[model samples]
Target: MRKLVVLLLLFGTIAHSQTQGFAKSSDGTPIFYRTFGSGKPILIINGGPGMNSNGFEALAKKLGEHNLTIIYDQRATGKSKLEKPSEKNISMDLMVDDIEQLRQKLGFDSWIVLGHSFGGMLASYYTSLHPEKVEKLILSSSGGIDLELLNHRDLVQKNLDKTYRDSLAYWDKKIRKGDTTYVTKLGRARALAPAYVVNPKFYAMLAKRLSQSDRALNTLVWLDMNRMHFDCSEKLKTFTKPVLILQGKRDIIPAELAERAHKVLQNSRVVLMENCSHYGWLDAENVYFSEIGNFLKP
Candidate 1:
């Protein structure tokens, strides 16, 4: 009877660690995440300065099968609550602080951080700030890291054929006037443009998530956060772990910028997909999944 009780206790301890979470960010914004599988922990952050968990469900399920992945919505987005707006607070630093708190609360000593788009920007910045906490890093179709993207957005957009890009003129008008809602609307067009394995379902799901999001300054999610402020690029050079940067051939971030990040990182690699736009995962879902899967596996 004693032996059986001991075995049960051990099993319960292991099970509890495999998948659990119910926490909050430093601002008291309620935060939630799920841990699945059992192995090295991989924390996945969703894109969009406003995207929540639903945007990452497909990618998370794929990663969870191999390593324990914790996916959470950023504060004020999805189900998570954000800190009340304040003049001196609520900066990107706050975003990184939220990640740190969530990880500590979940008992993950370390994690392989994966961020997509805006999340990619956050992950790179976070890894730069706390290289000690990250085991590996992966970014997909992100425009956040390259400061030059500001000056070169035309070159980035020029990658698209004239016929297709003409559709975006409507967006340029809205962006110049300081509109937020239209920025979110263009996010789908930006993400799901090419005529390939386009998933209306995914786009619709993403749209729904944005509609319900507490997104403020929607345009800043990728560009502003992605920008390396005073300590960013200089700090990114300090990362020693392996890095993988995945970009679409026609995606907004210049192929050159991806190369620049690789050149700066202690060790990194870049993969460009053919006939794909910004959302390489959707443009080349199978390849994207396999690329990240192989890199994250032990």
Candidate 2:
């Protein structure tokens, strides 16, 4: 009976370690985060600059089997709560500072960082600010800091079908007109779905998740964040650490951007997944996992 009680206590301890919690940033913003598995620590950042960590839950769990995977929602997104959210409070610098503070709060000296889409941009910028703190960097389907150079609007529109494009344009105009409601955001997600996935069903699943999360689509954050002070290409070139750039051929972010990023970085490798969209992990899990596994291997 005593042995059974001891075993239960042990299991409870393990479960508690995997539980979700909030790391308070310097400015008192509560950033929600979770830890999984154990071994080499890896910090995974989600995109949207406003997206919660839920979208990457599957991938994080898979990677967690070997590494200590940590995922967090940025300020004003997901479970993270922010008071009086505004452009001044959520700039790129503050976001990077939040990451640093979170690391300190969690008592991790350094960790591997994997940023997906817009999260990739954040990871890159964060590494630039504190390169010594990041052991390695992974950028998934993320373009450079300057959105204009990537031609996201033109490339995404060109690939999408006419129906999707028209719908996206209409919703975008609505969103710009102060209609950033949940329904309007879901409409935008549905319209942009084609650019992110080859399978319409996957898009449906993503749309459902988007609606469930109820993430507020803030255009100002997207605009001001992308207009960063630093040049990602030039800054990344200075880093001596290794970088892995994962890109999907069919993604809204053009493959050329990843290729260009690879060319600029000193120790970087580019993996262009054929027949995969922005959500490469969903489209080609085997290839994605294999590449990540190989890179993460000691």
Best by the lDDT measure: 2
Backbone clashes under 3 angstroms, per model: 2, 0
Q: Report lDDT per candidate.
A: 0.69, 0.80
Q: Write the per-residue lDDT of candidate 1 for residues 124-206, one digit (tens) a residue.
A: 88887888999999877665564555667465346545654665666556646766575545563553343212344455554
> In model 1, which regions exceed 4 Å deviation?
1-20, 144-146, 155-215, 219-231
- Model 2: how far residue 261 lies from native, Å: 1.4
TM-scores, all models, native as reference: 0.76, 0.87
Best candidate (score: TM-score): 2
How much lDDT does candidate 2 score?
A: 0.80
Quick one: how many clashes does candidate 2 have?
0
